[model samples]
Target: MFTEAQLYSPVTRTGDGDVTVHLSTEHPGVHDPAYRARRNAIAACALEYTSGAPTPRIAYTEAEEQVWRTVSIELARKHRGLASAEVLAAARRLALPTDHIPQLDEISAALTPLTGFRYVPAAGLVPLREFFGSFADRIFHSTQYIRHHSAPLYTPEPDAIHEIIGHATQLASPRFAAIYEAAGAAVARLRTDAALKFLADVFWFSLEFGVLREHGEIRCYGAGLLSSYGEIDEFRRAELRPLDVFAMGTGVYDITHYQPILFCAESMSEIEDVIGAFFESMDDETPLRARHLPTHANVPVAQ
Candidate 1:
């Protein structure tokens, strides 16, 4: 969730280089006549996060420290709640030194041993390809900051707590970790705009906002939705949807509001099964894609 527009705008180029859609974050704020006088022409919202738009870095405000502390402590405690076989238990093993707040440095020191990839502290969102490409190498694109507690059950944006405490802990499971890496590799190679959007759906619905089904019971798994107080109760026992045996269906998810529906997999092994299907479903031809496509390919670019 970025603070405002007029600093960085998402400008889409049409067939001949005409501006299509834009969520401007120009320096002038929204007071300029172009935005204020021509109010109806004002493009998107203040915290616009579209599939193709660049994910802006959100440097946590000075006021957010206390909230970060609250969430972190809770999740740290949550690591103990899961069964010894669960991913959270693995995260407990991966938990390294925290310097006041948990630094990416500390987290990586633990993760680097298991996987070649490390955590990268970022501002807002990384480009879609980079987000996946980093993962392709096992590197995790993480936001270095946390969301305030009052943030409507945690927005879909990957905040600091969401990354380090929420998602990184789950990364401890090698199989789940590999699925993340392979999925990133797939997204990196898919290259087309439509494919990237589909990857975003994977990240959103599964990695960030996914659930798991053990026996007949469903449980929260993904951090983006797990950090939420609003969603946890609804999805845990709810049907959500019958999960694809592979990571097939999470390719076109929606954010900016509560997810009315969720998707659940039976296990991490199931996650691998779905992702393996993703590989089989596509023919490799990513690099050939143009940087500036003439049309939307239904793939998402930025997270």
Candidate 2:
């Protein structure tokens, strides 16, 4: 369990006043012994947790087999019900192993080839630019580790459940992949903290906690929403809001709890295409909410 202070503290909402981004966890992900030593080496000087720190330390905790199994099984089952048939088909074709509640290794291996997308088990929460940059290179900044069992239902941070499921499956769609890269490239080309935050909001609303319309029915797809058993019911049943609805709220209010409002794209292709164009148009503009990342600090945002 996290210390009492960690459990009750206000989440650190970085950037401007409105869009409160919560740091999900001390980066969670497990790696094989080889990668454990080689990851940073592969990253070279580019690997940084903060501007001042060139290398970030990774943290690990043992999740009893049962605890890990419970979530893994639950996530797989949820994936069946909520994830598109297309994603599940891809999961099967990939023969993706759930590996002892699976870690980043399994996800990275499964995705790296399929979509040129790989998961980077984050050592900790990274700032906007770094996070966006990961996508720019076809890398998904993932927390290979899961949240502590105590968190049970919902947490403010992205853990394995959020990382692997929340975002990866969508990459299976070539159009989505193209759009993702386009968005990342736009951010990479622009290279600023503010633009990254805007993209993050776009990510949070669309990829992490978004709903999509399919075959005359709405579907559960976002990893962030899928992993939370409680949120799943509410999100699936709640009134749907368009993506532009939430885009308007960016940087104005830090969103927490179950998002009362959510934006649904008319179609993945349409959304992805629009997202690409949005990034292109805003390529060099600074976000009003962008700010420099702080080192060795975890600040909680106000609720």
Displacement of residue 46 (Cα, Å) in model 2 is 14
lDDT of 2 by residue, 77-164 (tens): 8777666555566556555445454555566666777778766545445555766666767877755434545544455555556565
Clashes of each: 25, 19
For residue 287, give model 1's deviation from the true position in Å: 17
| Candidate 2 accuracy as lDDT | 0.54
Error at 242, model 1, angstroms: 1.6
List per-prediction Cα lDDT, in the order shown.
0.52, 0.54
Leading candidate by TM-score: 2
Query: Which residue segments of model 2 deviate by more than 4 Å?
Result: 1-64, 245-255, 285-303
Task: Output the TM-score of candidate 1.
Answer: 0.64
- In candidate 1 the C-alpha lDDT for residue 191 amounts to 47
